[model samples]
Target: MTYRILLVDDEAMTKRSLYKILTGANASYRIVGEASDGAEALQIARREQPHLIITDISMPVMDGIELIQRLREDGLDMDIIILSGYGEFEYAQEALRHGVVDYILKPMKQEQVTLLVEKRFDHFMKSRQTAIIKSQLIAPISSAAERIGHELWIANEPGMRKEMRSLSGLLDDTEFMQEERISLLRDAASLISNRLQPQFPHQAWELPYEGQSYGQASESFAAWLDKLLNEIRDKRNWGKRGVIQQAIDYIKTNFADSELNLEKVLAPLGISSTHFYHMLMEETGMSYIAYLTQIRMDHAKELLEHSDLKTYEVGQRCGYPDYPHFTKRFKRQVGLSPSEYRKNMQQA
Candidate 1:
């Protein structure tokens, strides 16, 4: 992957030289922006949202340590490297405390800097890939358990009941490899039992069969199973109130796209417009439009606080067709307009 870098140094010549050397050494890397001082570096870092920052220890306005502290406070995740001419132990200690990835002395070789950056980039990619695989495995295991729970509700046979009881006992075992799967099954069973509490006040096996025949018992079990599965599936569906969270994840991945909307969102879920709206409200406790507005506003706040994106560009990136609407919603949610929020954040 091509990594974006930001170079910050008080000397224009030093910054230009370092940028040229780094870019020439690695075609896979790009110097996205350069800053003359620490203050300007922070602005460029936010606006460009570079993957990495290389900065000098001493600079006018804001120093490297202060910039790192401020970036951490704002929750920016860019990696930082500090450069200094003198070997000051105190400055190195401070940079380490602020979680800088590397500290290099001035008059350093170009090869040494490039090697350190490449190592960090490789580590970041490996960790992210591992997390994605783990999440994928958990989802299918949870879904399969939910299906088994639904099947048990419909069967309600003596043998199946015995199996469920056995399964519930094994759920707490530390030795089980499929712990998430078993926990999901236990949750589904508990939910079904809760739903039938009014009718079958006692345990499932203890329910009285006063006027009911065997066929009625079977029918009742089938109906209950259908209702339970529907409830689970509805809550799990991405288009309903759950869509609020889905919308957040979607926006995070596609925030750069300027035309994201409710229609495009509904297309993937394959639900009717009316049902989609109601489900979104039920799951998220807000209308579809309201939820979408909240997401856009929240994203605007992040950009205003962390990135140097102009207010209009931030609004456009967040899917606000009108800049005025974006400003209005941002003010309503954050208690300040976008520009005002940015000013307050910078001041703090």
Candidate 2:
């Protein structure tokens, strides 16, 4: 990639000579702007955001030192090379304190200029590539944490907890820089909380200690997550029984509605189909439809024994409006035709 260079000097001839040497020495280096003073260079720096800045120390209206201080204060990260005359050695020394990459004594040679640019450019390229790779690695952790959160809330099974623990291990991976890992702690916590907490409004989990160092914060976050998961597991265990009881009550009252399905049953409870399915299997060892049919058949047996309803009418009262379809299902489940079952009941 072409790296941009900003040339800052009070002399137009100096700017032109440096520009020509940079453009001629390397095809990868492009002079983006030339400033007559540090003030102009600051403006150009803000606009162009050059990868490297070559500036003279002696200039009117914002000298190089003041400009360096300003840029540093604003937290702009750029490689800077200072230019100084032989008599301005003190200025070069001071520039070194301000973190200039290198200083060139004036009456500069083409070779000196080209060599400094080449060295700085290599460092710049390496730094940029490292940053890009780090971001790529950290990017996927967000979505993975979100998926873990969904499963954690949907079911507090041991397998789900293991998956969550594995996701937290990503933060400990060495591929991320310390600062990136620290920042990701906040992001991971926020994502997990947003995904899981809405389903359990009373459960509270938050990242502890903002501004802590990466190692300290990561440890604290891991501990907090473990504690939060345990609390969630306990609460889910208590609430799971209540949730099933509530669903059973709803099914008993609404079994004959003909429109009862899993979605409608779960809508009022604000639970997902996957979660509801898991809960039913865990609690009753039956699928939702099986349980519903069992309820309907139990009630149908009561009607057959004590009521005078016809076979088809009895089926209709159990949420089956189609007579043959109801008769087929009844026989498959009961091993007798509905009419025969009613007849057997009469004899008994």
**Candidate number of the best lDDT:** 2
Per-residue CA lDDT of candidate 1, range 65-133, in tens? 899998898899888988877766688788989899988787877877878878877866765664554
lDDT of 1 at 211: 50
> After superposing candidate 2, which stretches have Cα over 4 Å from the reference?
70-76, 85-102, 105-115, 134-139, 154-182, 194-221, 234-348
Positional deviation of residue 209's Cα in model 2 after best superposition, in angstroms? 9.7
Measured with C-alpha atoms, the lDDT of residue 298 in candidate 1 is: 50
The lDDT values for all models are 0.64, 0.77
State each candidate's clash count.
9, 0
Backbone clash pairs in model 1 (N, Cα, C under 3 Å; residues 3+ apart or in different chains), count: 9
lDDT for model 2, on a 0 to 1 scale? 0.77
Q: Give the Cα RMSD of candidate 2.
A: 17.6
Q: Candidate 1 local accuracy as lDDT?
A: 0.64
- lDDT tens digits, residue span 1-348, model 2: 999999999999999999889898889998999999988899999999999999999999999998898889878879999999999998889999999999888999888998999999998887777676656544446545654564455343453465455555666654656777776667777877777655555344444545677768756766666666667668657454777768867887899978899988998898888988988765444688987886687567657756998888998999999989888888887777877777765542
TM-score, cand. 1 vs. native: 0.44
TM-score of decoy 2 = 0.56
TM-score of every candidate relative to the true structure? 0.44, 0.56
What's the lDDT for residue 115 in model 1?
84
